[model samples]
Target: MDRRVLFATLILLAGGATGVGVALFAFVGVDDATTETTVVWESEPAAGDDGSGAAVATVDGDPLLLRPAVENGSRVVRATVAGGDETTWTVPISGPDAERGGGDANGSDGDPSGVSGLTTGTLGGDPVAALTTAPGELVVVDAADGTERFAVDIGGPGGLRPAIGDLTGDGTPEVAAVGTDGSVRVVDGEGDSVTEASLSGDIDRRPLVVEPDAEAGERGGIAVMTTTGDPATVHLLDETGEARWTTTPNVNPYSWNAADSRDGSVLVLGGTSGNIEAVETGDGSDRYEVGLQDLPVEVGDADPGTVYVGGSGSVWAVDLLDGEVVWKQQYGASTRINEPGVGDTDGDGELAPVVVNRAGEVLAMTQRGKVTARGGPDAVVYGGPLFADVTGDGGDEVIVVADDGTAIAADT
Candidate 1:
């Protein structure tokens, strides 16, 4: 997906809200509240080792805090509510392990409904915009002119921001937004209008957005995954808001997270079947699948090229041209990494580093945020070997949200 479209979709669906009813029933439909269960990973996630990373810096008045939601050999960090002169709530990450709360499809424990996961950061793009809070309350400004380009409100604290992309291949980017009520909204950038679809009841959490296929002279397509019961309902929606196909795959392995390469190849994370599968953008068919012992925390593709998969203190680089492992490295049997950012950090010829393995390898900002780099299996130099940027002034900066509501902009 284009970086711009990616960030826009994410911001629009930032908060978790109530659940709504939908007609698509692909997963195991759960009439009772979602059971909360603790997952015991055979292996634990390790914290990253620190190197001479970059410092934090700011562009306009708005500060940027670069905090990668490191993988969890340690514990899961729960976003906490920020108090005092703050508009947004900061999910707390201070516990020994990050907290995973089970709710209905919308991440709500069963109430009017609430926001699920809301974090501040950027995907892939120059001059990336950071989300202030969940979308229901916050509006995205141009930053340059502070012009209100978009205003978002989804009933309660709706923040299930959509993933931005050109699913229809229409140049005009669209956003896939989830409402506080389990309703999914596909907003067109050109029209600035929303087309919504809902199931019979609230679909647990927000729908996972994926561009399943792109046909020559054909409009692109999108996949929306919602909880049916134990299964996941994957709906294929075209740019015209028409449902073309639907699939109910048995994916009880892990919670679902997804990322796509530049060519539109899709990777589904956290499979219950203990594997990570890559699906072709052309068809929903599986390209390659890898066993995943640890929870699939985060997924990132390299500058529209390399496919970097990281988990349990290890990183693997996959070549998209052919579902082949470029290289896989173990930085340490013990360490933890967070939300990873991949791009061309150095002026080198190759694409940005797929995964940064070392702790200090990350480029740290003055504020102490990090930019990570790692070597691909087929790589020559220590791809990104390690570094960070603070200011984002021609360089990258780490945007870490402080314990308080204030966003910390560190130099990379």
Candidate 2:
């Protein structure tokens, strides 16, 4: 029997049990010959690891995992490799003594007041990280070293995270950040303002930077969604920060970030309204809308024809064209699934979606929704998992940060 089919049969035989145990049994089977996950390496508590999310970038031809944290009342980013070479950079936020809102200078209270999640971009053709040190301040630093490249005051509190893309058609990446004042600012690689635009409502998530399609005569733009209104507004902005089109899908304002379609023709988003929506990239027209049993919290990896979504204790693979659900798996009532990382985790030439829930259960499922591998740090997990070739083994490994700040890499 096919492995996916056999795994599905075992799941049904177990009365649809959910949790790490079920995933392990399904992955390893009742036979001892089945494969098991191996820990590649584990790092000590990344100093003040915020457990928000992480980004991977190539430094000196080596893959480095960048983890965000707060250290000694300062916003800092730490980079590490599979072999344990590490570097730390303290981001200088604009405040009195590097503290926000008159907080303790030592940051002993674990306050990440002014810092947002670390996002990898580029500055002057060198790989850099865009760190929001405060609401109005954005800083770019070299990813390989702790050197500051440039810093700019964005003029408002950056409420959500920022995204990086080439907005100026100049080949260098730009940073798109949404401010609490209902504005979007585009900054070039040199820390200069490329363009800025205003919206009618506040944004709850980072602006999505869409790439241009040369063959389609489509200049890529940014997709921003408002979180303050019903039937959330989706706006498509040109490179100059001009609105190309704006439409409100039947989605809640605080939905997961929109994802670009495989061909960059549509943007997919999942909302608390229990609707997964796909909108045309050019005209902001509705392409499809599908309903689900629970509210979706995260929109995961988007393949050519399908997209993965994680909702209240459930993960779903949905067809992009007609809003059809290819498959769905429920992880019981207690699990709160995070965003999933998609990759060829098992060296099988086929991509799989790997997810870690709040309870720190790492589960990797095949494209057909069969649970193939399971591993975890055995601690609470707040951030989502990331996949990268950290070991230089020509295969991707699952990298996750536990709530206690431990970073673990596992091979499936």
Against the true structure, whose lDDT is highest?
2
Candidate 1 ranges beyond 4 A from true positions: 1-139, 145-147, 152-157, 200-218, 253-264, 272-274, 294-297, 321-323, 354-394, 397-412
Q: Any runs in candidate 2 off by more than 4 Å, and if so which?
A: 1-35, 47-49, 83-85, 88-112, 168-170, 258-264, 347-350
What's model 1's overall lDDT? 0.36
Model 2 agreement with the true structure over 1-412: per-residue lDDT tens digits: 4433333322222112221012111222222232455678787676554565457777777777777665676656677774474554444444432323322111112334456667886667788877664456677778877577777776676625678887656677888877666777888877788888888876656678887777777778898887544566788899888999888776663344445554456787766645567788878887766665445456767767878877677777776666666677665355777766688786667778887777767777777776766656676776677777767777788887776567788777
Per-residue lDDT of candidate 1, residues 54-149 (tens digit): 112123434322221334443112221111122121122222322223432322122111222322222222122212123343233232222334
User: How well does each candidate superpose onto the true structure, as a TM-score?
Assistant: 0.55, 0.83
Q: Residue 348 in candidate 2 has what lDDT?
A: 63
RMSD of each: 15.9, 6.7
